[model samples]
Every structure is written in C-alpha cells, then in structure tokens.
Target chain A: MKIKLSELFFVCVKIGALLLGGGYVIVPLLVSEFSEKRAWLSREEIIDFYAMGQCIPGIIAPNTIMLAGYKLRGKTGAFCALLGLTLAPFVAILLIASFVSLLLKSVVVNDIFWGVNVAVIILIILTVKEVWSVSIIDKLTMLFFLTAFFMCIFGISPAIIILLAVLLGTLRAKFLKGEAK
Target chain B: MTFLLLCFEFAKIGLFSFGGGYATLPFLYHMSEVYGWFSSNELSQMLAVSSITPGPVGLNVATFAGFKTAGILGSFCATMSIMLPSFFFVLLVSKMLKKFKDSPVLNSIMYTLRPVCAAMLAAVAFRLFLESVVKFNNFSDFVFNNVDFKAFLLFVILLIFSLKIKKDPLIYLAFGAIAGILLHFGHLFA
Candidate 1:
C-alpha cells in the first residue's frame, strides 16, 4: 500500500506522542507500524535507517522520522513530520512549565513521581533487550554488563563507566581486531 | 552565564549522543557533575518524564533541565541547542543518504556502539533503581517494615511478560501504570 505524505505527518504524531522509553524503543514500534502495519518500509530498510540514524545526531527517533519521511515524500515530508513530532510536546512542556511551581510543591505529587521513578529501571532493561543483538557478542560483554551495573549500583560515576568501557572496549577490539569495529 | 553554558553543554550532547536518547544519560551525568545545576537523582527524574512524554528524550531533557536551571529562556536555549544540529543535519543527510546509504563502516560503528550504549542505559537504570528501592530510612524500620516487595514483584512479572510476549512496550507500560495505581490502594495489596 502506498502511504501518502499527509499520512506520514500523522506517523510523526503517533511516534512523538505514544512512543515512550525514548531512544531506541521507537525502533521496534517502527518495525511493527511501518514494516508490518503501514508497510511503509521493510525489515531491512528499518535496519538501515537505524544504522544511519545511530551514526548521526540528536535522538534516534527524530532522525529516523526524518529519514523515513524523506524516503516517502522528500523534504516536504521531512518538514511536516518534524513539525508534528516536535510541536505538540513542545507546547505541552511549556504548559506544564506554567504549573511547575505548583506541581513540584505537592508531596503526594512527589510520591507519585517517585512511584513513576520505579518504572525507569524497567525501561532501561527493555531498551537493553531491544538493542541487544549488536552489543553483546560474547561473555566478555556479559562481564561488561555485570561490571557496569555493579559499579553504577555502588555509586561509581557514569563518566568513570564510560572511561572504563572505552578502555576495555579498545582492548577487546585490539584482540578481536576487525570484530570490534 | 548559565544560559550560555546551557547552549554549549547541550550542543555537546547533540553532537556526540549516539544510539538513542537514553544513550545520552552518561553525558547528562557528566553535565550535572560539571555544572552542579542538578543532581543525578534529579537527572533520573528528568529522564523518567523525558521518556514517557512526547518529543525526543534529549529534547524533553533540554527543555526540562533548562527550565529548571534558568527559566523560559533556558527552555528555548536548551531545546534549540540540542535540536539545531539534527535539524540541519537531517536536511543535509537526507540528500546524501541515497548515495552512501548502504555503507559498511556505518554498520560497524553502530554494531560497536550498541552494546556500550545499552550498558550506559543499564548504568543509569541501576542508579535510579537504588534511589527508588534501596533507600533505608532507619535500620529498625528497615528490618521490620522495610522492602517494597510488591513493586519488585510487579517489576519482575512485567519484565517476564515483556520479554516473553515481545510485543509493544505499551503493554508493559500499562501493566506498570496499573501496578502503580494498585499499589497505591493499600487495601488491595494488603
């Protein structure tokens, strides 16, 4: 089925609003929607967009939206999708900002905020599962995941994690050579 | 000074953040440390709202953190600074994507970053978990009336379903939301 440029505009809205967990979480949804539901793109094409999006800036979702939009309707599609995705949340955040003083003041509101906070750990786990295939090549990576988690748990700063990751990754790449990339 | 720092800082996040929005967490941690504008705990909160709400996490964070630090102008600067690179890069890349779209080097980079990025997400997630679940107000209270076992069970159950079902994340999220509501009603769990 041929998807129209205007429909791509709505795709932007669907992605921007409903797509949560941010980052790569949008990928599986894009796969289900565009590849399976809308049939806008195929499995291979989605992977390609993901690869290229990773190589570039901002967030994966927006860049993927841009690439997907451009694929369907050129620059015009890109602009509309970007607009639809960016505008609503932009306005919503502004509106919420108007209430920030009040919202931040309530203890009950804060408790709920803490309740919602519990979900983020799950979000990250799910994100890891979604983006798993590329990263965890072997037990070395398993070790990395464990080490990283423990370090983070004990209050080691993430910058240190990044530093250690870069070092370990480089070492692994040296031994693995081309496999490390 | 803070405003200018916001622009420069977000610009750095814009340029280097790869994999996805959450991939920027490590950088956010660094920024928080450098400027001391926000704590890691607050950064985690910004992240929770950023993910669930509309717009990109990076974009939401720029707006949220910016507004927190300064005000309206911080929002503008944060949003614009984080977005400017992508807005222009999108225009530039869409033109060239057709030609170099199937490159192998791009594949290699993504493949490598994928694991590192996931680890980054996991790291942030772990910290958030400790803050939410592992806090101890007092030893006696902790010994007798401690542990939010219900939350932990809900998380585990939802995690199993999500991995097993492997469907849309919205299902797991809905389960999470419902769990939150149910947990709030003390009678239900008790």
Candidate 2:
C-alpha cells in the first residue's frame, strides 16, 4: 500500500509518545499499530524487523520503525517515520532538561532523585538479569562476559572492548566452521 | 566546534552501541570521564530522567547530555548524530535483508557482542551502585558507617517489588519518588 508520508509520520509520533522504557517494549506496540490496527505491515514482518533491529547499532525503536518505513514507501517513508518517532520525545526531553537545573535546586526534587537513583539501580539489575538469560548461554559466552567485565572495570574503553569482541567472535566462528568441514 | 565534536562522539556511540538502550551507558560513562561534560552523579540523574521520560532511554540520555554540554543546539546535534548512523545502517540492511538475515558472520559477531554488552552494563551498574547505594572511604575501608542504609533499604524494596509485579518501570520510579519524599520527612522528624 502507498502510505502517505504524513500518515506514516503521525503514526510513528504516536508510537514515540508511548515508548516508555525502550528496548523490546516497542515490539507489541508495533505489531498492534502496523500489523493489527492499520494493516500496513504484517506481524511476522514487524517481528523480523525487530530482530534485525536488535542486531544493529543504535536505538531499536527508531531502527525498527525506519526499516518498516523503508519497506512501506522507500527512503522517504523511513525518514518520516523516524522524524515522527523522535519528534515527541525530543521536544519532551528538551523541555524537561531545560527545567532540570531549576528542579534540581529544590531539595524535594533532590530527595526524590535520591530514591529514584536507587530505583534506577533496580532497573539496571533487572536489565542485567534479562540480558544475562539471552547472552550468557555457555562457557565461551561466559568468558566473553567476564573478559568484557574486567576490561571495563580496569578502565578500558567500551568501544575498544566491543571491537575486540567482534574480532574474537568472528575468528572463533570461522575456526569452528573450518573444524566442522 | 563543540557541536561538531558532539556529533562525532555521539555518532560513534550510535555506530557501536549494540543490543539495546543500556548498551550505550558504558560509552556515555566513558565520555563523561573523558570530557567531564557531566559528572558521574549527574549521569545517574540523567539515567533516571531518561528512564522516566517518554522515549528511548539511550536517545533521551544523549539529548540530556547534549543539553548539558551546549544547550538546545547541542541536544539537536547530539540526537541527530546518534540517529544518523542507524539511518544509513538500517537502509543498507533493508536492501540486503535476506543476505543480512542469514549471514553467519553477523550471527557470530552478535553471539559474542551480546555478552560484551551485558558485561558493560554490569560494569555500569556496579559504578552506579557505588555512587548511589554505597560508598567506600578509600578502597580498603569496609564499614557500616560507609553504607547508606536508607538507600540500601529502598533498593531492596524496589528490587523485590519489580521482580514480583513486573510493571512498567515508571510505576516503580513513581513509587520511588514518593518514598524518597516520605523518607526525607521521616529523617527530618527523627
């Protein structure tokens, strides 16, 4: 179907406005909006895009939306979808950030953040647990996790660590493939 | 000049940050350390703000960091730069969707990259834990006085509640804010 750029943009804006915590949260919303509600895309296609989004760099929500947009109406569709997806949150964050300093000056705000900080720790811990279930499946992966953890603790840059993992992972996979041959 | 630098740094972050939103934390932490654009304490605050806000946590934090460094224009540059990499990457992948989907090399990279990303997040969690929940006076001293029991208690409660209920993070964060206010009043009375 030839989806209008404005229609695509507005739909994505609605998604952006509802994107509360990021990550896989966008999946159900995308399935509902694009597949179930509007019929602009299929559920399976949305899932595929989401899986692809996870593997790629950048935030998954916009990445997935952009891919869907590209599929729908090529590049312009993707751009509009991206603009729609980001515009709401961009303005919202700018507004909050502008007043953040003034808000921080208030003791109540500070105290609330104090508690919120602890809450954030809980959130991070949950994230670690969630990632752990998917990422650390065996000894080799465990070693990868440990290596990166120690490197980070020892003050190595994360960008370098990620690069090293890519090299190591690719090499290991290649060796395993050769052995299987 | 600073805008260009922001674009460069965040674009790099965009290109490299895999897995999900929190994957960007390690890079942001490193950026904070390298540039002092915002302190670690402020990073945690930004994390909190990003969490409770209406968008991707990674994007929101980038916007906050940009705003912190160079105001509105900085934020615009930072947000756009971060998304730019994804724009091209996704477009490229869309054309080669079949090949990309079945590529063993990509699978292998993700196989290891996932753990690395998780580990980085663990490292970030550890740092935030020290800053917000506990403090060690020097590295050697381990004492009860060094621990913030109030924060510790709050952490335990929130963790348990989150695990059991599994609601949106916003709910827990809202509860946290209320708890914080109440705790402050309790401290005042005490």
Candidate 3:
C-alpha cells in the first residue's frame, strides 16, 4: 500500500487548501483524510503526532503533517508534504497582501469574516472535545489537564508548562518503576 | 540584506513559537515594533485576513509580513526560514520516537503530555470564544449586553449542525458565509 510521492503531495495540497482556522483544527481534518479515508494512519497516531507537534517549535499543523508524511514514505515524502502544505497559503497570502487594503475596506469581506470567525470557534470547540476524550483518562491525567489549563489561562508560557509536564511525567514513571521492583 | 534579515528573524520565530499558531502573535508584534516593516494596525488587519483565509494563520502572517518587507522573494525566504527549524526538529523527533517506540519512559511522557496538550488547546478555544463570540464595551458592561447575540446565535446553530450532521467543516464554513451575507441584507432591509 505504498503511496506515490506525487499523490502524497496532492493529498497534502488538498488538506492545506482547506486548513482555514489554525493548527488545532488540523487534527480532525487529518484524521478524516488519512485515517478514515486512506487508512494510512490510525486515529491514535494522528492525535499522538498532534501532541508531539505542539511540543516542538513552529506551527503545529506542518509539524504533524510532516511527521505523517515521513511515516507514509520517507524524507522525500516529508519534504513534499511540507512543500504542498505551504504552497497554497504562500501564493494566497501574496495575492491577498497586494490587495489587502481594498479587501479590508469591503463590507462584504468584513461580513464574511464575521461569520467565518464564528465558524472557526465552533471548529476549535469541536477539536477540544475530540482531543479531550482521548487525553483525559484518570485522576492523574485529569490533574495534568487542570493544571495545564489553569496555567494557560493565567498567562503562563506554554513552553514552560510543557517542560514541566515532561519532567513530572518522567519522574513519576521512574518512581512507579522503583516501587514495582 | 532584507531577505537575510527576514530569514534570520522568521527562523527565530519558528524556533520559539510553541503551543500553536496564535503563539506566534507576540513575536510578530515585537517584530512589528522593532522593524516597522508593517504597522501594528496593518498587523491586526493581516491577522484578521489570516484567520479567514485558507491556510495556517502563522504561515499566512509570515507570508504577508515578508511580502510587506521585501516583496515576493522576501515572502519565500520568510516562509522557508520559518518552516526550516520545525522541519528538522520534527524529523529528528520522529526518528527518535520510532527508535524508542517501546520505551516505557517515552510512553509515559507521551501519555502525560497528551492531557496537557488538550488543556492548552482548550485554553486557546476559550480565548477565541471570548474574542469572537463575545464583545464587551468596557469592564463594567453587563454580561448579556457584552455578548454579541448575533454571532453567538450563529455559533450555536453551527455547533448544533456540526454535531448532528458531522459533515466536512468546509460545508459549514460555506453555510456560515451565506448566512452571514443574508443576515447583513436582512438588517439592511429592516
């Protein structure tokens, strides 16, 4: 079930074309396209990549997609995926940036965005619900979620919170292993 | 020189922007203040455009900002530079994850990180909810008065439809745009 590089690039192009809201929205979209439709990756794998993507620097969507591509093919696949993901947006922004002043002035544009913005909220809410079911399992995980959520709300940098979680998780695993032994 | 500078600056942003796309806002704002490549007003406008456009908002902003700084080539350089760090880093991590797929320590770390990531995303959604669905005139405004009923209504209707139908989000987005236009016309006539 090897996918050609060209096909991979085109599939990614289609995904990139529809990525309207932001990184978080990429989760369900990729799940559907890859896991549901193509059977290339599992739902768990996509979410795992997404979580890892957030841990790394740069935009989450590209990092997740690049990892998916790497899994599907190899380095070339990753490169193609990255290129495809950026292509539409690069051209689009270039086009829009030139005439942005005019577009900004248009009441029609404003109205459309006003509505689209609301739609994006719905999308993000859906993403949170989808991710939550898989992430929060027990009391410890629940504690992790609550602490991270509050820290984020209170304006703590996400990088610090993530680092803390990783350190805490590693130490907890070691303690549990020692207890078992 | 401008292209080189754009590459260096954007690459730094790429390396540092954790969490998600919105996380890049602070860096972009600082860049705006220092470089004056685009005014703060223009940056907000770009953010608005980036939100509704069909792409990752961070990448869109980079493209727009780069173009503003040095035209087409600047945009290319900026985009590539911004993506470069993540590209290499993810590749390295992906390789490591595969190599250490069965390590209990690694598994525990991922298990813990999942909930934290979910929490971070929830936080992002909450902030967006405030920005898009609610509008407050000032600190003292009543909650009911502060909420934008029209947008809130649209959000509720779309949320219900999305939950019930489970269609591609593009369909709902299209429906939202049409509904918005209709609402605008309806207001005009009323």
Candidate 4:
C-alpha cells in the first residue's frame, strides 16, 4: 500500500501544530491519529516508534513522526514528515523572534519578561525534580547522576558524557551479569 | 559563510541536547560564548518566548537564535541542522529498533541515561537560577547583596502552584507576564 507524500506531510503538519509541552505529550495524540484513526500504524508499532524516539537523541516528538513517515513510505516520507513537523515551529519562532526583539525594548515588556524568566526557572526546576524522582533509584544510578552533574558543571561536553555513560552502563551490564552467572 | 556556521553550530546543539528541550540550554549557552551571535540576556528572553509559543522548546529556541543571528535563511539552516541528527537516527536505526528493543545492553544504557539526563537538567536549572535570579560577583555577593528578592519570591510561588496543580504551563507563563508587569509598575508608583 503506497501512501502519498502529501498525506504524510499533512499528517505531520497536524501533529507539529498540535504538539505542545514536549516529546512525551505527543504519545496519546500520535496513537489516536496514526494507530487508531488512520490505521497507518498499529498501537504496538506506535509504541515501538516512541521507544525508538526516546532511545535516539533529538526531539522525541518529531522523531516519532519521522518513524511513522518512514513506515508509511520511505526516505521521502521521512523528509516530508520532518519538514511538516518543523514548519509550525519554524514559523512560530520566526514571528516570536521579531516580536520579542521589539518587546524587549519596552519597560513594561521588560518586567513581563522578567516574570516569564521566573516562570521558566520554576518549570525547569520541576522538570529536574520529575526526572530526579525516576532517575535516582539506586546507588549505581546515583553515582551516574553525581558524576554527570560535576562533569557538566566543569564544562565537559554533554555528548561525551552521554557516550561514556552509555558505554559504562553496557559494560557493567555485560560484566556484572557474567560474574553473577 | 554565516549560514554554514549557523548550520554547524545548531547541528552541534541538535546532536548533543539529549534528554529534551531544556537540555539544549547548556549547549546554547556555549554557543553564546563562542559565537557572539546573541547575548546571554537575549537568550533568557528567547527562553521566555519559546515557552509561551507553540512547538518543541528546543526547536523554537534554535529558530529564534537563527533569526536573530542571520535572517530567514539562517532560521532554515538552524532548524534543519538541529533536526538533521534525529532524521539520520530514524533513517538508520529504525531497522535495528526491533532487534535492540529487548537487548539487555540497550536496556542498561537507557536506564543509565535516565539519571545522567536528570543531572544535566539539574545543572541547567542551577545555572539558570544563578544567571536570572541572582546576579553576583561571587558566592558571598549572592548570599548578601545580589539576590533579586522579588524574582525569587515569584519563583517560589510559581513552583509551589505548578507542583500543586500540574496544569498547562501556559497558565503560569501568562501569570508571570502579568505579575512581572504589575510588580515593576507598582515599584515605580510606590
């Protein structure tokens, strides 16, 4: 069954437009649209795509859309989906860039933005707490958290940190299990 | 020239900002240091707009940064570069998805990534707090003279409310904007 590029693009555009918050929030919407309504992908398949989204680096929301597009057609579908996912944000940010530049000049706007800054901080702290609750589950994981924290503060590149962490984790899993066996 | 630099820089951001949108902040901060494309002050404003506007927060920041630094083409370059890695991952790794799904090694890595991501976010949160809420020459200055008490109060209230309600973050953003304006004006009047 061949799906048209336009169809894939439009589906992604809809997803991009409606997707707010971040990657995780897109799950239910994607499930309903792709798996339930269009029948383009199965529920299990959507979950697989989401899992892949998390596993991969980059924004998870559009990653899921890209996978659905690939499953629907191929590379062309993938690009189309990526484009569609990007379109809303690209436009929205551009408009915001222009608007914020002007807004920054006004004293009242400055105060408003100051408040917004506080809000952003609150949101970030909440995100840290939320991720912390789930991430800091044991001694080994706690070690990872502390080491990663110090590395970041000292300005070691995050890409390197993530790679090292993944490598250490894989090695520990392999070797520790062998010893146990 | 500039366009390509924009692409390279944002692609770097795209490649590294693991965890999620907020994770991009540290990378963007680095870019601000190296490029002089935008000031740290402007980046704070971009963060505000990114939150208020629709779309993934990281992508929105990338787009805003691109536009500020260059123009329309820069926006395209930045957005595309940031998104390119994800596309590549999907194109390449989708095939391995099924095979790796149940692999213990993969599971371990994912489990390990969770804590690392949390730590990264915590780092960003602390840095941002220092930059926005307290401007001090040193730790003692922060402890004494430099803390922005009004901003700190707003942060505490917003944090408590958000945790209690867990509503759409947009509401808080709106509240912040209004509260900021009122506070600033009230100070003038008093």
lDDT of 3 by residue, A73-162 (tens): 978888999998888878888898888778768787777767776776666567667767877889989999899889877767665676
Candidate 4 clashing pairs, residues 3+ apart or interchain: none
Shift of residue A57 alpha carbon in model 1, Å: 3.5
Q: Please provide, for model 4 over A1-181, each residue's C-alpha lDDT reduced to its tens digit, 9 standing for 90 to 100.
A: 7777887788778887877654446778788888788888888888878767767788767777888888888889889988988888778888767777577788888898889888888877777887788778999899999999999877777777877888887997898689889
lDDT-better candidate, 2 vs 3 = 2
Across A14-116, the per-residue lDDT of candidate 2 in tens digits comes to 9999998654478888998898999999999998998889888998888999999999989998899889988888899899898998988988888998887
Per-model TM-score (chain A alone): 0.62, 0.93, 0.68, 0.84
Task: Let me know the TM-score candidate 2 reaches against the reference structure.
Answer: 0.95
What tens-digit string does per-residue lDDT give for candidate 3 at B39-155?
A: 855665576667667788788888888988998999999899999999998788888886555677877877787788678767766766675567642366648766788988888
A-chain TM-score, model 4: 0.84
**Per-prediction TM-score, chain B alone:** 0.81, 0.91, 0.65, 0.88
Native contacts retained per candidate? 0.45, 0.79, 0.67, 0.70
Supply candidate 3's per-residue lDDT for B93.
Answer: 85
Sorted into a CAPRI-style docking class, model 2 comes out as medium
RMSD of each: 5.0, 1.8, 5.0, 2.5
lDDT of 4 by residue, B64-106 (tens): 8888899888888888899998889888876776777787887
Off by over 4 Å in 1: A1-15, A18-47, A71-80, A104-108, A139-181, B98-104, B136-150, B187-190
Candidates ranked by lDDT = 2, 4, 3, 1
Report the TM-score for the A-chain of model 2: 0.93
What digit string (tens of lDDT, one per residue) describes model 1 on residues B1-190?
8888899888777766656777767677777767888887777667656656666677787788888778878887887787667767777887887665565544444444456667777766665555567654334555524556766676677667766766654455556655666655665457
Which segments of candidate 2 are over 4 A away from where they belong? B137-146, B188-190
Candidate 3 Cα outliers beyond 4 Å, as residue runs? A1-61, A64-77, B1-48, B56-58, B61-78, B93-97, B137-146
